[model samples]
Target: MTDRTPGFATLAVHAGAQPDPTTGARATPIYQTTSFVFNDADHAASLFGLQAFGNIYTRITNPTTSVLEERVAALEGGTAALATASGHAAQLVVMQQLLMPGDEFIAARKLYGGSINQFTHAFKSFGWNVVWADPDDIGSFQRAVTPKTKAIFIESIANPAGSITDIEAIAEVARNAGVPLIVDNTLATPYLIRPIDHGADIVVHSLTKFLGGHGNSLGGIIVDAGTFDWSKDGKYPMLSEPRPEYHGLKLQETFGNFSFAIACRVLGLRDLGPALSPFNAFLLMTGIETLPLRMQKHCENAKAIAEFLSTHKAVSAVNYSGLASSKYNALARKYAPKGAGAVFTFSLKGGYQAGVDLVSNLKLFSHLANVGDTRSLVIHPASTTHSQLDDAQKTAAGAAPDMVRVSIGIEDKEDLIADLDEALGG
Candidate 1:
């Protein structure tokens, strides 16, 4: 609104896109080919040497994917972005750049069950350690930091629980420790809260969710705030050290603000081999165009459903931060003032069996493992999403046996409430 620039809605549709120069194609054309032709040996040399920027291989970059990256970067107000095969891949690419063997990163105990598993098990295999901290206790984060700690990771709004994290407070902790704050803004898309604006150094997304809106595609992205001092204290070698592969070029010295994103692409994506397809990128871009509209409806329906459940005799508790009674309500107001996001967990008075029954009996709502769909979805995280965790781990992550998670959709609120009423036998 300040410099008379395009509003979010306008940027969503027009950012990073222009009329096709060759055929005037209005829609983004998927460059499905695996490689791009170079002008000559010098052009090829410059691209491969990292002296110039252009598409070399689909495994690293593509025209369609680049558009999605730029659009997301613009939305998040980041210097640059890199699209990946999935959200997990995006996190992996970011960590691969920062962490070395025996290094540790502190993370909030409450997170998506999949991310918890990924950070706990997969990262251990890489010789990288994960130290847990309670997001509710700022002192817990301070205690978790050590000399080897390289970063702090948290969700803007945790999945299933719908708990809102105080990103600014945690960012202060990271700043004091001289480490980057990596925020998983998957549930709270840029429309609701841009993590970078709240002091995050790197923002990651599960494009499979709200960013893609439809459940039709699997994609992810990492937006670089381009604010971190990678060369400070010489902690991030991938950015500060000269690379033998690129004729001893130091990425930070070369790219300046966007160096981290460029490192993720040329170094991580190229080697790890988790590239997003041009087709999926096209699908995600289409979904983002309607993000503002769908997200508003989602928050509206979620609030209505949360209100109804809170007063229901069969419901014991609801974890929606949008509710005034929620412990996270103030933090939600500070961070995601738009809404606390659509995904939240609730417990039934009937306990675990009742939770299972409610999921099974839902008529209009789907029982599935995925969220952020146009259609209402319900699942018992104890039995599905967080099934891999032990009892203590599950409880720590807020997936109790009596809990059922719901991803409220952009559907008719009346129909959605009616379905729940019938399902609960009211």
Candidate 2:
């Protein structure tokens, strides 16, 4: 077949995949084996030593997962990508590759509750400190930067609250500081926005969300934009300096622009062992094929829901970026013009108990921690996801006691609205 530049839909289905060379299988077969066969001792040695890029173990790489990685990279306009067992695993790998003990990173306060815990508590054990900045204040990111700061992290559309970050502004901050800007594009998938095109040096995703739209798989991917020059200021010694593990070869010198991918694979995945399963990779690929279609409907439904909630007597405030009155509406238009995404939060006029009652009363919306599924989801963040945080922290992160988050799905708009109406009445 002739090589043709494929569009988003075509690449989602065909990129990083071809018929199996050995068996001529049309489907991406899960190489379920623990390891691969080498031609001889030298071949095995080269693979193990990282002299050649081949699967040494299932924990390091798998053929099925590789296709998923490549497809995600292409979709995100990234040079390469690494698949991991979970979104949390992907974040850990990125931190391990870029940060050393005593290094710091800046992140938006409006982030996933799990990510906040990972950055503030778990990452603290590694001697990496996170400086929190308000997503609305671009100058706050610049002010938070210290000499020890190595990276800047933000969610393209923050979890629960649906706040949209100014990727270009944040990227500028990182650029001025000579560091990489990392964005979590889980809520706003590549179909809505590709962070790399907006100046992000690296993009991360919880494929368990929209990319794995069925909510049947748990996976994550880190994509390298291949635009940042690690050797420019020698800040990232891990990439710019020689590594004894690979016979003292410098990653940037050897791998050029795609060195970040090589570093994550060789140093992070090889040591950390958070490899994504081939079965889950297959599931995620299936979901990604219809991502554009599902996301469009998701946004449309969410806009309707947000509009309804804003005018409702029971709702004190609505935080959907699609709404004209939303604090993030301008940023949404700038970064995600296609749609403001599905996940959003609103405050109940009746307070915490009413929020809980409403969640329980809803029939169509599933009360779950996940988002981006075909089915609508609801959660009381203060009682569930952000319960661990203190009152002060909870308010700072926009998870108040009266707050209820909704992940609008492709369900019938009227049905969703009626469910919310009945729930609010109760």
Candidate 3:
């Protein structure tokens, strides 16, 4: 290869990887062991003290997981990244790193149902309060800020709802507030949009979805843009202040730009103990190698399905940003021009009963709670994923009772449209 930087597909396959140094194996080998042997007493001390970077325990880091982290970081245009057991685990680690007890964070109301539950309930137990804002109203985010606000969170392409958030606008709000903007780019994936390029300070992903395209592995990642100055406001004690665990060393001063990623790995991952297994890391890496190809097909099929649903008499509305009629269509063009992503929500004129009948009648679409799979999947969010929330909360989350979510897959577009047409009583 020439000095020219590799393209997305090339980097997806080769970034952060080389033939096995010891065995010369072409594929990434799984370092399945639980511990790594240090060279000597000083080496062991250096590893423990954060003075050196090498594997010590599988719980914090592993050779296989490191490759996955580096690949994801490069894909997202981030300085560094951390891999975790699941997407929720990744969120927990990042929140723990930035938030102290009694602190608050602002998040867009439209997000994954599981995330809403995690932020609203589980985080509250830790004294971390979530202030919700409407993504459709930029001023809502502005009004939600407080002196205790630590960060802002939003999904690039929100799950189920298929809304495209105005990431740059929110980044400005966070910038003016002296807080970082953390975007979960799970649905859009790096193949479609890179949040950091639009002024986001950090990006997170549930690699279990599109990144692991086959849906065979569970994983999540946090990518540090390395742009935020943790020491500027003195608000983030976890990074700005001295740490007794590492001999009173200040993380921001030592690690500079990538300090936040390091802090998540050493402090949060170490204590939290949610480690991604090496075998799963290997599977995710393989899936990523074909992400570009798979995402293209997924988007093409979803656009066709969305268009089909819009014209049908029985359909009340389609929430896909790819559709010209969608309120988020303009935002989708600005943020993700290639396509508006595959996961989207639509409602039937028959209301709740219609949604239940449509899902049950669809023979081709597998009814499931998951999205970003290689095969088409469907779910009634109000009855399943958002079941824990009350009616008001469900409506706020875009999971209205009449709505049905479909994660269009890499299947032939004609077949997908045909199946939906038949299911809709064509």
Candidate 4:
């Protein structure tokens, strides 16, 4: 075969997949068994000692989930990947290996509401502290980093507002601080912006969103770019120091480029126990086969709806990056030129009551909590998703009390526009 590199569309359907040798099945078969048999006594011992690459149990590894991990890694341009039960699980697994008790990480204030809550409250229980920085001001990240900082985290296309973070600039800060830059690329996906290409050391995703596309599955993944020097400052003992579980084997020394993925699997997932089910893995893989197509439609429909809202009398402001007048337009053009993505927020003229009324009045849009579904969905973030945050925290996250967020789908643009127009008193 020729050594021609496959395009994104080609990789979406074919990466890490092969026909079954025995059954000759074209689709990936779900290996439903919980435990895999070893070759013999020696083989079992080797697998247990981390000397072999075979699976022993479903909790640690499985064939179906392995395919999902490999496919996501290939798409995100990373050395290796690990899948988890959900986006929250993915975040937990990642920080577990990087932070010890009382260590800190810098995070952009413009993040998903759930993530803000997780980092602020849930992570604090483990003695991990999150220092907030503004994405609009690149210097904020630099100022937030201290001696205790181990990583910097941001989103490619932020939720609720669809603002684009300056990935390259923040990556620079992480480099000088001797810390890894972790980017959550769930909003843009690899189809739009590859975080690794912009100097991200690690890329993460909530596969349940754009990757799944149908909103039918719950999954998340972490891609190790193999760019960070985990052993350099001796900050990350989980990878640099000898591991007692593996008989004094140092992960970075042994696995080299992909050691982070290995540490997460054998150390984090093993103890945290947030395993992605093989059945969900099968569904997520199938969903990824058409990501390119679904994302295109999602972007096209979102831009059109944003334009409609920008000119409407009932709307005070629209926060879509695709709009030329939006504050985030230039950053969006630099990072996601194809389109600004499907989720964004618009403020209503009448205030918080109007935002709630608009979602109730809309016919085509489903009033729900989720995004990146085949059908369009809408929600008032201040009342639903971002309700837990205080007044200042909600505003910082782009989820203002008088704002309405929408996730456009693969529907006809005219139909979506019509729904918005009627809802806004056409």
lDDT of each: 0.93, 0.90, 0.92, 0.92
The clash numbers for all candidates, in the given order, read: 0, 0, 0, 0
Q: Compute the lDDT for candidate 3.
A: 0.92
Candidate number with the higher TM-score (2 or 4): 4
Which residue runs does candidate 4 get wrong by more than 4 Å?
386-397
Flag regions of model 3 displaced more than 4 Å. 387-396
lDDT score of residue 246 within candidate 1: 80
RMSD of 2: 1.7
On the 0 to 100 scale, the lDDT of residue 121 in model 2 is 97
Across 117-236, the per-residue lDDT of candidate 2 in tens digits comes to 999999999999999998788999999999999999999998768888889989999999999999999999999999999999999999999889998999999999999899888788
Q: For residues 301-358, could you state the per-residue lDDT of candidate 1 as single tens digits?
A: 9999999999999999989999999999999899888888999988888977887889
> lDDT tens string, model 3, 87-111?
9999999999999899999999888
Worst 10 residues of 2 by lDDT: 48-57
Mind giving the per-residue lDDT tens digits that candidate 4 earns over 315-337? 89999999999888999999999
Summing lDDT over every window of 10 consecutive residues in candidate 1, give the lowest-scoring window: 391-400
RMSD values, in order shown: 1.6, 1.7, 1.5, 1.3
Query: What ranking of all candidate models by lDDT puts the best one first?
Result: 1, 3, 4, 2
TM-score of each: 0.97, 0.96, 0.97, 0.97
